[model samples]
Target chain A: MSEVTRPTLSDALTERMLELIRTGGHRPGDRLPSTRELSQRFAVTTPTLREALRRLEATGAIEMRHGSGIYVGADIERLVLPNPNMREIHAAQLLELLGARIVIEPPLAALAAEHAGGEELSALQRVLDEAGRHLRGEDAELHDANMTFHRATARMAGNSVLNEVVDSLLTVHGPEQREILQIFDDRRRDYEEHLAILEAIEARDAAQAESRMRAHLVDVKTVIEHRLQSPR
Target chain B: MSEVTRPTLSDALTERMLELIRTGGHRPGDRLPSTRELSQRFAVTTPTLREALRRLEATGAIEMRHGSGIYVGADIERLVLPNPNMREIHAAQLLELLGARIVIEPPLAALAAEHAGGEELSALQRVLDEAGRHLRGEDAELHDANMTFHRATARMAGNSVLNEVVDSLLTVHGPEQREILQIFDDRRRDYEEHLAILEAIEARDAAQAESRMRAHLVDVKTVIEHRLQSPR
Candidate 1:
């Protein structure tokens, strides 16, 4: 190992790299110098530079394509992120996650109703239609469609930070949510609830959209709670 | 450099490290085997191990003390985290952040009012008191106290996930928020608003607490918005 491989060296290099990005005004997808070039510029050996790059990559600060070069990551500017290291969530945490969605997503739905543009509304309709076709189809496709619907509505609320927060929650909720589709087992009702939310949004009925969202999430949580108490 | 210093090796090592942490049933702050032992166990060189360790450290999946060994990170299980690499916020992103808080925090304040126990309420009161003392003092201290007040109220709301979300927001909002304090420039009113929210929580008046919290954040956001329009 190089003498420069100490933790402090890596920490300093991370800070310097961030400074370089900021000073260079590199936006997401903008390329940074190559690893070899970066090491030469920073006067560090390749191992130390690689360690810093991995740290940046782990947190979505930067991207490192193997044969390609480095680029700023899309999530670098996001205020919130899903814990990338989360492998599994316990039952209690899963319910708490739903509770958070209950508190958060409803208001965003109301905002979506108030603010959604014509193009946005049609796109949202398309997402629901996709979900409808997959209602009886594979779990993964339906789950993706379902998640996209929630994400699109949150985006329509016109607050990127809230959108990031909701996206992070859904991303971390991924596996359990798929299992939720299996256990909640009312794929039709689930699809219908989502449709109701979409209709309310399309009609620009903010109150109706908000209440429907709350009801839908509460229903899902209630079913999950009951199932958890007596697992099949 | 070792032949194993490739990006794929680093990625594989990161996954293996996560597996080790999970399969070993380690909780936050639990000590893991030393780097030498971990290297021996995993059959990778020290440089590869260090790269993985740095990635984990950056994301708070693990902590590496300088001379001490590694411990599982407290944030490993959290569903949401502040983006650790956020260096600065643009004026627009900052406004959107406040808008997000306006949507999310009010409901939490109401929940805090409904669910806060005597001890938790007292603790929240103490946080505000700390803020009060620093009202005319250093900006950083007052900022810390105010943040603690918000975080404690979110915690008292009894949802860990929401608390994580709020904490993440506040964490990323740190530096810009201090600048906001100077711009908003009503230290006394800021302190007073926090007191009113705490009072409503203590009174267990959920409606009053929620509205007060909402109005307070709106007040701050309005001031910041105006200031951003015409900077000092």
Candidate 2:
């Protein structure tokens, strides 16, 4: 007999899979067994197995490798706290987390501005510029570019904790979560907002950079609220 | 013979024990094996077993029945993230976590102000008063009370997702983090700052409250930076 019996199949497979991934049993780049094999062993149908896998992918847990196979993702699991049950709006939680951000990131950006070699800044600059190129024209490419700049800033900070947490923010908006960008008819405003924040960071004006980054998130919040009111 | 075997006897016991707790293989609150019994069953000495058992208990993975026997502990082990790792200031992770906080929190406070009710506001009042009592006198007590007041406000916001995030922030504070409170010579001044922020919230002066909070945090940031600069 195998050292351990397989996990039982159920509607909660997605959650169980997540539990496995988060608990470190599933390392990045570990290939999952084929869906057929997994289903047969777990006594679940192929469709059921696929359903859980789909959600996992959506959350950036596992990636589909096309002809290759499904594998655990690298560095995708960021410091996302477990969500509380949905009843309250969790405002203070929001404020506390935000307060911490304001205190930390401005310094990181300032450090980046002073220490990041030209190559790093240019890479970030390129991301901002590319995001500008497709504003309101198309979203997927622009969104990716925007993320690249944020990650680049983290890389410049030389802090893994900072880098991982920022990326985790993007994780919350994982696959299809980007449907939020559709809320604004003229997302050019948001792009311009990003431009202001980046420019301040580049200028090594830490305070201005923090302020603009915050100002930009205001639009983001507005867009998020609108999208939630009537999903696309 | 027992089917379970491992490279190390302690490793096998740890695995079996976690499986027992997580799978409810043993009922909650049920007393577990004595060290003597565990050592005999696993063919390991008491010290090796103690090391494994200690690891589990430290993580809240299990509980000793207090001169009784070991039992299953609270399910802190269920959490996906290791908060202790994320909270260390000297370590490199704080900045990233803070970045995520920035994006989600300011609006949370504004929303909390918009929605916090009488009972919740009254609770905040009580916590503030209690916190004020010890602010200048005992540093440890003051930090605890101050955190209580802050947490009370978040609890008032009634948002689960936001609250969960805030809980993470609480876990990140330094073990002797309260020692920094002495940096402000007159604790009364800090308490008054807290009172002003509370009043601002109570009066529904969202702008004033937010302004006060940001200002208070800026002073705190300077103190913390100064402390970090000093010898450990």
Candidate 3:
């Protein structure tokens, strides 16, 4: 175990190669550098290079040949990729994300009305109940749960695009959100607002559901903005 | 040209390898079979395998080493991504793309009333005129133009998330959209409706703008449902 220093020369070399391939426009059926060439260039042992290559192969980057070199794969566009080294968002970027949600969430609610089955609705019912409970000083971190409740509604919408977008938005609650949402600290008012929206949905009134959702979102936006303007 | 006699053995081998990666849950850094090993398994000449591997490498799948063997690359997960593959209703998907737009557009108009720059509203004036022309029988494909017109409005909202969600919706409409919509063929009425909404926005009347947008969406949905229930 002591001899195994974490991620030896081979690991680093493999990472370098992967960076090269990704930056390069290698698509499915593309050929790679020969084994002898890679080992020579990276100044690593053949066995170590081979191990690293194996790891990449297992991860679905390329296909190996008996006598031939490795080839690339297909449809490499849909994966949840990370933009790790991105600079911080400007106010412009934050506004953009909010604008996107404004467009995306309504149809999401509509779809929820259309596709959500009993089980999905039941789960949402629990979220609503829990949110109500949380509003009344029951949970310290009600913000997280409240966010989850909205996410649950999106999931029931049965549209993968909506699901992914809403999910991504919820995961990164920026300073804007933390600053803006202190208004929810009032348990009674918040719970009442939530109940009105859920009750409208439970009644199977799509118009009412949509109406309530918009109003609620507006309220949220207003609160968030108010918080931004005022210091703690 | 004479040497290219068959369906290319390299191509066949590469496809097989892609299947293995997507289905096999292979990760980055995996090693590929050596030339000798692959040649024996696939019963192909080493040169042919090399051709296939080259293609794969071009696609960011595998890399070659000088003394070492081939290693897998990162970004493989993105290589064979999952997506809804419905290409038939490309047009309707475009309309459904509008489904998301209704959410952002009216709100955007209201926001513009409060926050948009003078330059922003001025840029859209030409778009409004063209839309009016289309409504008056200038062209049949105004429906398509109409969608873009609304998208531009969202852009004016100065919200990034709003823009991203709406655009992402358009991508999905690449296929699986035509089946969902039927143009009412009442271009005159539809165009007039558009003008009403646009006029409300220009006047900075947020309530009127919002009401016009909501009413327009309801009208469109009714038309869609009616068309579906009784199609020609």
Question: What total of clashing residue pairs does each candidate reach?
Answer: 0, 11, 78
Candidate ordering by DockQ (highest first)? 1, 3, 2
The digit string of per-residue lDDT tens for model 1 on B64-116 reads 87777788999998999999999889999999999999999999999999999
Report chain B TM per candidate: 0.96, 0.63, 0.54
TM-scores for candidates 1 onward, in order = 0.97, 0.51, 0.49
Please give the C-alpha DockQ score of model 3. 0.07
Candidates 2 and 3, the one with greater DockQ = 3
In terms of lDDT, model 3 sits at 0.57
Better of 2 and 3 by lDDT: 3
DockQ of all predictions against the true structure, Cα-based: 0.61, 0.06, 0.07
lDDT of 1 at A191: 94
Q: Rank the candidates by lDDT, best first.
A: 1, 3, 2
Q: Best candidate, TM-score-wise?
A: 1
For every model in order, the fraction of real contacts preserved is: 0.69, 0.06, 0.10
Clashing pairs in 1: none
Task: Give the best candidate by lDDT.
Answer: 1
Candidate 1, after superposition: displacement of residue B135 in Å?
1.5
Per-candidate iRMS values, in order, are 3.1, 13.4, 13.9
Per-residue CA lDDT of model 3 for B1-232, tens digit only, reads 2212223454577776666555665668887767677768888765555555644554456666645776665534321112222222433433444454455456765665555567767766767677666665544346556666566666666665554444445444533322332356666666677778767778888788777877776677567756766877
DockQ of 2: 0.06
